[model samples]
Target: MIRHLVLFKLNDGVVRDDPRVVEGARIFASLGEKIPELRFWECGWNVSDRPIAYDFAINSAVEDAEALRAYVEHPEHQAGVALWREFATWVIADYEF
Candidate 1:
């Protein structure tokens, strides 16, 4: 099995109240369930004082590395990026056994 996790920090001035931001999150959360490779997915807001709080994050588990790769190339995920492009300024990550 493989785990795929991604975290994002939204661009300055972007807020949860914005319809675009809301839709982006919803679309990604749903995409996790729609893809065959995505076994688990969770997303959230950062209430902590961490510097990364400005970004939206996605943590997902996949069947394996191949599936993880496929997940990224998948059409739905590609389409999803369109929404992410609107507000993300930076990202963080961790991938391991």
Candidate 2:
């Protein structure tokens, strides 16, 4: 199995309640049901107030490299990414388990 993790930081001056941010969050939240390659999916806003904490996160898993590739290329996933591009910046890590 592969674990895919992502941490997102909202852009300066942008709040989570902004209409665009809200829509972006909704899009990503729905990806688990929309993408078949996603074996596991959990995403949400960060609850901590620490300076090092990112604004959002995505914790997911897939079968393997091929499955990961498919998840990355999936159209619904791409659309969510596009929406996020406008409001946040993120980092990702993937590893075999």
Best by TM-score: 2
TM-score of each: 0.84, 0.98
lDDT of 1 by residue, 30-69 (tens): 8867898888888877677776355666778877768888
Best prediction by lDDT: 2
Task: Give, for candidate 2, the lowest lDDT window spanning 10 residues.
Answer: 79-88
Tens digits of per-residue lDDT, candidate 2, 1-97, equal 9999999999999999999999999999999999998999999999999999999999999999999999999999999899899989999999999
Error of 1 at 50 (Å): 3.8
lDDT (CA) per prediction: 0.76, 0.95
Clashes of 1: 3
